[model samples]
Target chain A: MENRTIKMTTPLTKEKIKDLNIGDIIELSGVIYTARDAAHNRIKENYENNRKQPIELEYQIIFYVGPTPAKPGKVIGSAAPTTSARMDKYVEMMLKQGITGMIGKGERADYVAELCREYGACYFLSIGGASAMIANQIKDVEVVAYEDLGTESIKRLKVEDLRLIVGIDSKGRTFQEEQVKKYKISK
Target chain B: MTRIMSTEDLIPVIAKLCMDACYHLSDNVIGALKAAYEKEESPYGRDTLKLLLDNAELASKEEMPVCHDTGMAVVMMEIGEQVSWVGKPLEEAVNDGVRKGYTEGYLRKSVYLDPLNRVNSGDNTPCVLHTEIVTGDKVKITVLPKGGGSENMGTFTNLVPADGVEGVKEFVLKSVLAAGGKACPPIVVGVGIGGTMDKTTLIAKKALLRPIGNRNPNQYYKELEEELLEEINKFGIGPLGMGGRVTALDVHIEYYPCHITSLPVAVNLQCHSVRQATIEL
Candidate 1:
């Protein structure tokens, strides 16, 4: 199937996320927040305690990444999505607070898929290990918090033409589940 | 007297090769990606492979890493029995090489002090160095910058000898199915059949350093690799497991003899990134 191109700028709205289909290609742009294993641990800490969180979740999109440091002249070093499953434990909190979109690679838990459907959210995937290609899409990056965590620091980024696909849409149509349905039986 | 090799001379060579391997996608890997792109039936899979090709090109041209996860440096040092070196211990030399390469190359430092402590080592060091002494006058160093996403999918099983090749085929297929996109499709499958559990895994990893698409020198293992490759590609997990025709770039098997009572199988999946390099001096 030919993929449809999309332009997404955060804060992502429920309407925007709902419009995506599983496997639609996206040429995402605009501001996005970055966090990974350590950052998520911190977020869950605040979430369960009813403390003020790091970044606002309302209408925001979080990308699961821990980028390498930028070289002398580069805007950002190679930046790519980590495994999404690592953050599956925290998906409910983010979804409950209205995080409309997520970007990462790999499959997530079944509950995360159900949550996306219930919350009008979407899960997007990029080319795994194509960090140099992904880095070219970022215009700027800054560590907004958690600098002590080194590469795992929470950061903000401005990106342009970052390519991705909807791995799981709001309706709960997921790339992985569908792929298994198609191929596992045929062979 | 054994021939003398300076530690300083080998250090820089190892450093340069480590850095270069991370930045440069070797020709064989690039060739395989290109071939997969052309042969892939699904548009998404093709696009993914194309982006990887572009990533490799950009990395080499810009002298940046192909992936943000520059990877844990696994260095294999094969020193000739006739050769001796005056300098830091071999492990220290390997670590020194990783230290310079990760820092100077602007690569990500991923070594951790402890699994639970979760503290970054600051500079990527304490290389997983494998040393061997063979009959020669030279030293050969091979570096594999292994990524975590794919490394997490590696599995080893001790099947009784009765399970045999059919059992192995089942395990290989099932492992790829379970790994799906998590290990990254269009992956290089490295299989080590026989040996002890740990030895099987090491040889499985060593299998990855062989050029992609090359056959095992042994006729029996070569045929097994070919059959496994065919079975894996038929899974329809395409690139990134999104659905397509190609699931594996190649399946490589390396084997050693084991006791009559047991068969040990180790499967190591390397993502499409496929970073590796070798230098002989």
Candidate 2:
């Protein structure tokens, strides 16, 4: 089957989100927020106490990553998704706050799968160990919030043609479960 | 007479190994990934392998890290009994090496001073070092810069003798399956069997020291390892666990005799990066 590549931007609306499906290969180019465990905790803590959210996240895409610090004369170090499951505890909260797209590697918890269905959100995965190659796709990266968290800081990434696969779709379809079924080596 | 070994000598050699491991993916690993790439049916899976191979090439050619997570330097040192080191202690020397390598190389600083306080170590130091003394004058050091994603998915259990090979197989499968997409398959699955609990797990980790595609010498275990690899890859976890034909590159098992009552089994996973380098002094 020929996989078609499409371009999309951040803060995707619900109608625009529905056009995407599980296993769709995308070359996303736009602004996305990067955050991981520590940053996720701080976001949750702040939201619970009714503090203003760190950034305007409504309908935004959050990438689960903690990039290595950049070397001199480098735009950013290898930037790739970390494990998404580690950030599962905060997904429901973020979805409630209008984060519609998540990116990382690995299968989400069963509850996370359920929440994606309820919230009409999607998940994307980047290739692990392909960071050096993937690093070439980014146009710019800046620490947008929580700079003290080091690599875990939320950053605004301007990406061009950043290739990815839709691991989970807004309709609750998933690549790890459904897509892998066809290729299973029969016992 | 003892041959004097100094932290002065150990630090530079170990530090060099750390940088080399980050810059280059061993040949065996590259070979295995290429082989898997050739046979993978999913275009997505194949593309992922291609990108990783590209990353390996770019990192090697440019002297950049293969991935951002240059990892915690898990250093294993073998000190010959005849060699006595002066200056800092062995652990401190290894940490010094890791610190210099990560800082000087401009790699990511990943260590935290305390779990509760969460202070970054600034320099990636205090590497996990293991030492064994044997009967020679030379020192051997191995650095496996272990990343967090894959390390988070390892499993260990003390299986009963009755549980047998079948039990071990099931455990290894479940561990890899649960690790799907997270450990970055086609991973090198390392199995440790027998010995006391602690000893068994260390040997399991040590099994990762072998290059990808190398099998245990024991015919029985080698056959078991092959069978396990064949089956796990069948689960369609593929590269990046997104779903595909190849999930594991190889399975390496190490075993030692244990007490009559216990059959301890430990499974440690190495991601596709398979970054490790060894130096002898």
Candidate 3:
């Protein structure tokens, strides 16, 4: 948990993710893919049925989000992280696909941290409900697949200086668990 | 003498309420967030609170939704007993307003046509509407756009009368802890005590509509609210559960008398982006 912010780019490697610790601040830039519950379900189904996935998952980052419709002249609408815990079941499946990074809000199941350690992946936390501020960091958006899914579609996002905190590191340490214990007062 | 009120007129007003509630968070919420920002002990938690305040300001200035999940429209209407309705059916008119508001306002369409089939309703129609007939000729409507993250974390349980207040407190603390960052803490906890099972959950959600600083009015309940708030903060769940001093902005309890055998309790958690609005005509 370093009190310093580190800058990182997309298509992250396991080596790059290995040293990152829970509670480290990150300024992430470059391409990431957005997928929420519906998109994940479709992705999993496609994998199960041996169909080609819409987006290549290897060495990629997945952000759990379902943004509102963009206004005229806007690239995207209020975009923020949905609860990550809801996507916990899909984590193992996603990690198996060679995903190195996961971003969203909330505390996840314990096994998610273990999976991160097992797969040498990292989980980042974005501030929940800070949609407008977070949306400002997104430079461009393209719906790469599942247009029928609307907001749940898998979109390629180009974000610049997107703020995030490491929720779980590759080592399996979780910031929420450590920090909550620190500040909790005995009854 | 009966006053004729047309349901047709409600569409535009409800539409505006929906947009306004989504775009601009109310003053009470803004104030509470600012206070939470000032008092938050954890640096990470404080920074999160600051971002939330900035997000609210940005969303209002741009006339965009404060959060992406614009939520299912929860409408509470108080209609005058002396009024007679004409024009479209009440439910249809309300859904029309929701559809218009979500579409025109550029908000997300989150509601599904059916739970099992899992098809998007597309227009965000078929709102959850609760109506009550009251004394005046005027009609009052409140639109609360409740996000899914917090709504999904809500809980309900029926306890034996012997369990009493201790049981209620224990249940509430457990619920909040279990919700953790998932419910998006620095949350407003709406606790419903007494009543039947369904009614308890309804009032629990309705309790969130109250101003953050306002107490339950009853001295005993007011004290309980204060106690719960203090205890919750002590849990260190903090903002977004990153951990800090102020886990909850407020605790509101709404209770009703129930049968002798049952003590039912429900808890509804509202995320920091509490968006709601009310109007009277």
Compute the lDDT of residue B215 as modeled in candidate 1: 99
Where is the poorest 10-residue window by lDDT in model 2 chain B? B5-14
DockQ of predicted model 3: 0.77
**Residue A41 of model 2, lDDT score:** 96
Q: Which is superior by lDDT, 2 or 3? A: 3
Task: Write model 3 residue lDDT over A140-168, tens digit each, in one string.
Answer: 99999999999999999999999999999
Query: What tens digits encode model 1's per-residue C-alpha lDDT throughout B1-281?
Result: 58998777777788898889889988899999999999987777778888889889998999888989988989998899999788887677778888998888888888898989899899988778899999989898999988899989999999988898999989888888889888877899999989888899999999898899899999988999999898888788888877778889999999999989989999999998899989889
lDDT of 3 at A174: 93
- Which is superior by TM-score, 1 or 3? 3
Chain A TM-score (model 2): 0.95
Regions of model 1 farther than 4 Å from truth:
A179-185
Docking quality tier of candidate 2?
medium
Clashing residue pairs in all predictions, respectively, total 0, 1, 0
- Write candidate 1's Cα lDDT for A65-101 as tens digits: 8777789988988989988998999898888877888
Those runs of model 3 whose alpha carbons end farther than 4 Å from true positions after fitting are none
